[model samples]
Target chain A: MATVAVENYLKHVLLLSEGGEELVSMGDLAGALAVVPGTATAMVKALADEGLLEHQPRLGVRLTTRGRRIALNVLRKHRLVETFLVETLKMDWSKVHAEAEQLEHAVSDEVLDRLDALLGHPRQDPHGDPIPNRAGKIDSQVYATLATCATGRRLRIVRVTEQSEEFLRFAEDSGLRPGAELSVGERNLVSGLVTLTRTDGGKIALGVAAAGKILVEPRG
Target chain B: MATVAVENYLKHVLLLSEGGEELVSMGDLAGALAVVPGTATAMVKALADEGLLEHQPRLGVRLTTRGRRIALNVLRKHRLVETFLVETLKMDWSKVHAEAEQLEHAVSDEVLDRLDALLGHPRQDPHGDPIPNRAGKIDSQVYATLATCATGRRLRIVRVTEQSEEFLRFAEDSGLRPGAELSVGERNLVSGLVTLTRTDGGKIALGVAAAGKILVEPRG
Candidate 1:
């Protein structure tokens, strides 16, 4: 059985990879985990020895099948727990991430299965992140974001890809949650700003980089 | 911030003390924790240094007010989680103890409060153990067990005090869960056996030792 620390490292690596055939740089991994680069390197080397991941000297790291499986399982527990906290417990969505971080390592597969069933096997979490199925397969279909979607086209917010408490609170206040209907009003790349008009006709403006974190799709 | 091991140690100390003024012996503490006597002693000494507990040479260890507070909080978490598992999740009462062991350390105070409310602020867990309140106060009322209660009276089972899988399975099979109404049919002191007749006209036989674990109260 992998220790909690090992599971955390693997999950962070998989998150950094972001469903792509890319290596996660040591600096980025270290930053994500809030660990020093040297500490991340030592731990990465240890994980490589266990055959859970591959480490390339001075370049980056990638998960092996075994590591990915564990990471996906951890991720499944995390998102499902977040769903339970917000949907069942009526907790604030912006705060459930921290709670889920502790619970993911503690929940058993049996309890998780029950939670999944209770939640009706939700396709995605409250934040619009797709939940990985029991088989470790995740839905990675690409979607347009507020930054690049065509202006004046009806759109539905599909995801908010960041867990920043500040941003999520703002999104909640602005009625920008997943499944909320809106349209891009203006995109000024020169000024690095994007403005959205909600179906309620409420206008919200964001910097280009922050706007990119909100994934959306053209409404029917 | 107590580590998981530290919480486990303190909880065991409180448990073995049995709600009375008594010190926990190193031998019993080690046995409960499945640690060596030396290890238990070392840990007790360290806890004493931190003023979490008072360790008396060759006598035993006892929790100070600070230690007791933490232990009670952990106990509250454990019992509340067990209640949620069985009452909300519809899990087997006999199996929830192990699950709660993992969750008690992971659940935060905020989540615990919500769960407590969600479960309608339960005062007792599934097995009939009292849950500590947020203020660290616990209900420790004493009750008679089948082994010593007056025979030939209408009685209700109040608690099953052991978490032993085999014994709990037997209890479940016998329909002797908490709130079960039954009357003692006979007590053969020489044979060390106790016989019970349920209100539904079912008979169950148990050894005196097993009978003592089933606490009860007289039904009006």
Candidate 2:
């Protein structure tokens, strides 16, 4: 069994690569895990020795089939647990991410399946993140972010890519949660700010960097 | 924040001492934790240094007030998580103990409080084990085990103290779960065996040691 640290490393790698084929940079991996680069290198080498991932000295690491399977399983546990916390326990959605960080490592696959069933097999968590299925398959659909979507066209929020408490609270306060319909009111490329108008006539301004974390799709 | 190993050591010390004022012998602690005596001694010394427990030379160790408080909180998490699993998730009572073992160290106090409220402030878990409160007050009432309860007297199973999977499966299979009302039929001191009769006309026989693990009280 992998230690909790190893699981975190693999899970972060999966997230940082956006579950894509691109090679992750060592700096990005270290930053994502909030560890010094040297520590991250040491662990990456150990994981390589275990055949869970391949470590490219300069480019960084990528999960092998086995590693990706494990990472996906961990991700599945995480999202399902978050869903249970919010939907079943009636916990605050903004707080469930931090709670799920600790719980994902503890829940067994059996318990995860039961929770998934209890939640009626939810496809998305409280944060609108896709939950990997029992077989490790996840919805890989790409969507436009609020920062990049065209101005004046109605879009519904699809997901919030950021997990920070402050960001989530801001998004909630701005009525920018998943399924909320809104249109880009204005964009200032020089100033790197975007203005949004909600269907209810509420307006909110966001920096391009923060706006990029909110994924959206054209309203149907 | 105590590491998982440190938490386990402190929890085991409290359990071995039966939540009493007696010092827990190093041998029993080592055996219970499945570690060598030397490792137990080294850990006890470290924990004593940390002011979590007091260790006496060649005698044993006892939890300091702080250590006892932490242990009780961990126990509370364990029992409440077990209750949530069995009552809310509808998991099998026999399987929840192992699941709760992993979850106890992960759940936050905030989440625990919400779970406690969601379960309607359950006093006893599915196994009939008392759950410590938020303030660390546990129901410490002592009761006679099936091995010691008088023959021909009606008794209700109060708690199944053993958490081993095999023991729990056997208990469940034999209709000896918590709250089951029955009477002791016979006891053989020399043979180390006990016979019991359920109110529903079912008969079961258990070894004296196993019988002692099933606590009971006079039936109302």
Candidate 3:
């Protein structure tokens, strides 16, 4: 049985390796986990010894097939728990992340299956993050950050990279969510702030750094 | 911040001292937590120093007011999570215990409040355990073990004491649930087995040990 700390590291690495192309370095893992590079290196080695990770010194760390399965499972649990917390518990989206972080490691498959049934097997969580299916497969979306979108183009918010609570609250207050259509109204070359008009007839301003983390696609 | 282990111990002791009763012994704490006596002693002392517990050598430990509040909050979280796991997640009641055990300590007040709202402020969990309210107040129930009931009396199952998977499966197969009405037909003194007839016209055999752990009340 893997410890919760080990499971968290594996999940973090797998999440960072989205698109199946990127390799996660020790520094990246440490940054993601808020730990020291040396700590990340030691943890990576431990995971490698447990046959859950493949590490090439000076390169990056990748998950083994077994490790990937566990990581996906953890992701699935996290998303499902978040959905449950929001839809059923009436929990604020910002508050559910921390609770789900701990619960993802503790819940059983039986509970996950039950939760999936109750939530009608949602494909995405409140934040637009994909929920992995039972087969450990995720529905990947082709999206670009709002900062990269051309001005005057209409795009639908698909997902936002979850980072800080302040960022999530800002997004929520800005009328952003999965499936929300928006038109880029203006862009500031100096400040990189993007002004957007939502389909709901609301206008909001987003800082360049915040807009850069939001994934969107052209609206049909 | 209380460690998970310490929180668990405090919760256990608080639960054992229901109705603002007296202190709990180290041996009792150890038994409840499945730890050794020496370990329980060390933990009790630590908790006492933290002002979460009042320890008397050779006597018992009691929760401080602050400790009681924390314990009740943990209970509230656990019950809410279990309800979410079963009602939303479709988790088996038996399988939810261990998962809820870990999640209870990690969930925040915000999450708990939201979950409670989602569950419509449920009074009891999947296993018929009562949930504590926001003020750390729990509603008391007047119910007795099925083993003590007189034969030929009609009663409805109120709760099950054991949360093991096997026990839940047996209860499900036997048509036992929170509102399942049954008539006790006969009791085998030698084998300690009770023969019950379900309202749905099914005959079931329950071991005396199991029956003794199941709480029920007279049917209306």
Compared with the true structure, all predictions reach lDDT values of 0.95, 0.93, 0.85
Which lDDT value does model 3 have at B170?
84
TM-score of chain B of each: 0.98, 0.98, 0.93
List the lowest-lDDT window of 10 residues for candidate 1 chain B: B16-25
Give model 2's docking category: high
- Residue B61, candidate 2: Cα error in Å is 0.8
Docking class of 1: high
B49-166 per-residue lDDT for model 1 (tens digits): 9999999999999999999999999999999999999988899998999999999999999999999999999999999999999999999999999999999999999999999878
Better of 2 and 3 by DockQ: 2
Per-residue lDDT for B199 in model 3? 89
Deviation in Å, model 3, residue B58 alpha carbon: 2.2
Q: What would you estimate as the lDDT of candidate 1? A: 0.95
DockQ of 3: 0.64
Clashing pairs in 3: A88-B118, A89-B114, A89-B115, A114-B89, A114-B90, A115-B89, A115-B90
Q: Model 3, range B1-220, lDDT digits (tens) per residue?
A: 8789988998899778764679787888899999999999998888889999899899998988888888888888888988977886666677788888877877777877777877788999998989999998897776778788888988988888787888888888777878789888998979888888988878888889888878888888
Candidate 3 C-alpha lDDT tens digits along A17-95:
9849567988888998999999999989989999998999999999999999899999999999889878876767876
Counted clashes in each candidate structure: 0, 0, 7
Cα lDDT tens digits for candidate 2, B1-220: 9988899999999889988999999999999999999999999999999999999989999999999999999999999999999988899899999999999999999999999999999999989999999999989899999988889999999999989889999999999999999999999999998999999988999999999999999999
Scored by DockQ, the top model is 2
